[model samples]
Target: MTSSPEPTYTWGTTSEINSFIRHLNKSHRILALCGAGLSAPSGIPTFKGSGSYWKNHKAAALSHPETFEANPGLVWSYFAERRRLALCAEPNKAPRALAQVARKRKGFVCLTQNVDGLSQRAGHPKERLFELHGSLMDIKCSNKECDYIDKENFAEPICPALAGDPEQPSSFSFSAKRTFTTQRRDATLSTKPSRTNAHEEYKYKREPNPLEALLESLSPTITPEMRQVVIPESELPHCPKCDSLLRPGVVWFGEALSKPMFDEINAWIEKEKKLDLMLVIGTMAEVYPAARFVHLAKEKGARVAIINLDAEHTGGIGLGKNDWMFGGDVEEVLEVLFEGVLLNG
Candidate 1:
């Protein structure tokens, strides 16, 4: 792949993009590989990125099977917060557009790495969608014998221990060069230094990474004392039949996707002699198996297009001169990309 776009052309959005859109409209079989970026517009924090510091612990730390085994309470709490936010989020335009198109299109499949279920909320057909990472809304038993599973269990908090837990802090990190004071922000003396007079303005320079930002974002909702909360064994959610511990259904760090999903994908590939179009939407096709689909599609005479935020995104892996890269907010890109195809008339 060419490393960089020419200086004369900013992100390589030439008239050729129109030709690509025209081709997409005519295509019969299409595949969209989606990721966390698809749901970011709905005020949800991505689990894989730097912004995923849940209560001062790295997302990678809390999402691992090892962490869940040691402290189920703490792990459950992290998911509870994520679930709360996910339920509150409305499906954005990108999902709605995809759903509308999938309704009319016969050979479209969406394989998503997101667990938020936003696409389902947008009325995407169940048979056409595959969730690569298991949903947060599911709960399952740890014991393989029991194999107890509850799907779409939207019950708040999942258990009593997680009930009434404080909300997640701000999802962003800001940089401040110098201290600033505002009389209007915090009326109470809680945030203000005790040494400063109430009537006077107080300026404190806070360099927030993970730990430092914890106070400002959590305080008033989640107190500093609650940072290292660990639920008792009895309080953590357990299975009803086998009496084993219950766990979130998401794919952890050292887990493989279920075999049935692979079978479904295999059938899809075998059914088509040639895939007409492949859209890598909101995902860096860097991850395995899923990423390989992009290469396979291109190999089978499919026109590849990437819809993401970065123009020079080589991470999509299989992109080349013949492929198209529409760089922008995914919602905006999808809205334009599917304009003619989404029309019911």
Candidate 2:
């Protein structure tokens, strides 16, 4: 016998959405999966849309081991710009609602693919929140030999050594109070023959030459006669202990999700036996492992609700009864989705 098609819901009225929200709040074990879309309402751009930053340049091009290996400066410059932008962004209503529910309810948990810490900024505790893709706020030593990861490192801007030029050293700027220094490697003021653009070096996938590497280790300074002066390796921000390059603490396209985070999610699914509800907010369910959560929740008998700006691409993705779609501004829709649920408390 053939099976029937899965049913999907699209609520049209406030009352209906409120009714669902009421039902949703009644769920004992709630799992929420959030993505880049969750931060769009906060003026941040998503990764795969028209206005997305990644659309202009292939995301895979700049975020990879090869790119970092070719020119650590370029990679660091890109991530430093991301860090700069994230520092200026604030959490929107969607995050606020998720945080409120997670905090108010007993069995609420969140798994997010965002590097931005908007969820945490919206008041979700670190323990209850699992950033499966890692975070921009966290910095890790790039040296494979060093096991140093600093969660407190919120430092911004490319180091002067890696700064582009005088006019646009980088999209961001670093704090002067924090001096760039290292004890592992000796650095001195030096110069070499001029060469190709740093951006082109990666665009063509060419290995950086010895002089370029040495220049990359020099800090940039601006003087009246010279637009930008190149200082020494003493200016590159290196790991305090190992004195290696510091990289953004994010799970790149080829990297695995955090082991602890994966364990926690698996344990939750195994322990609960029946996950009551799965709230998928703002994501298109594109990437893996984490992307499979919706299906897993459905298999485990949990109702799934997806809220995104576009619904056409989401409805046919194996959703079932009690699986609904809310297509609109996440903040506006969430205002109604959580109305009576929060007010009644």
Candidate 3:
């Protein structure tokens, strides 16, 4: 016969809360993996949900290497707005909330997937923090020969050309406009169905080619109102060393993470030798590499603690009896975890 399910402690229930408090106080090594959900209360949109569009382009589409190579101005426009939004968003109260615990627990490490720089603003110790995804605030040269890179730059409008409201009337070359309009008129939208365009639907089915991307963007499936920026390539941010095009420092799809940074993180893990706790916050570490890290920590004896907004979805992920799941707002969960629980490590 099955024995019983492991106890899942939510924000409520005094007994469970106290037990977690004891766990936090006794743990020697703790790691927290943060995600986009952590910044939700801070007014930063995840941009992963349906209908997240900018000038008829999805956030992911504009962030790709192919898109940037084809239309640097358009890609820059999207990222510029995102950077502005990130800067404008204040670190959530829960943000500083984690900072307090990290400060108290010397062995505690925070591994955040967000590139918004909120963790830094919240005052988490740099040595103890691991940014799996780099920050949007940083800048780097796109030219292969150029070695230009800048970190933690909060300056607005990064460049003069991307300045002004991003929602203003956009400009596209006559040829591009003509191609887009001609495609729209030629295709029959009513005949096709799906949130994605025909090209997107069959991307994996077809062989890879640069010509396909160009044709897809000009496809009728693109939002009828999609607009492209007019800023010439010459005016975009350029590398001081080679005057080459500049790109966001954040990692894009199909890009490898910084090896040096990973080395530092690996060193930290090896030095610690074992983990007592791993706070899974905001994000579900389901993807590989990131998931691999969490798996390693668990193998090293870390108990998983998930703190997220979705209670129903998180309830039954087959957590071991030793693990804890805190289902509720991040701020509330953090309050329960730190405040009134334990002040010092």
Residues 50-140, model 3: lDDT tens digits: 3245655665566667677777887788788778768887898677888877787788888888898999999999888878878898999
The residue ranges of model 1 lying beyond 4 angstroms of the native Cα positions read 1-14, 166-229
lDDT of 2 by residue, 1-345 (tens): 999853222323444475567677678888899876688666554534222222133344456665555556555656666676677788988899888887777688899988888899899977789998888888888887898988946555546554334465333222111111110011111332122221121111111122332232233221232212223335656898888877788876556677877888888787867888888887767556887877788888888788765544573356766667665456766777777667764
Using TM-score as the measure, the top candidate is: 1
- The digit string of per-residue lDDT tens for model 1 on 235-317 reads 88889998999998888765778789978886896687989988888767776767877887787788888876544454746
Model 3 regions more than 4 Å off = 1-12, 166-229, 314-318, 340-345
Clashing pairs in 3: none
Clash pairs (backbone) in predicted model 1: none
Cα lDDT, all candidates: 0.70, 0.63, 0.68
Best-first order by lDDT: 1, 3, 2
Cα shift from native, residue 166, model 1 (Å): 5.7
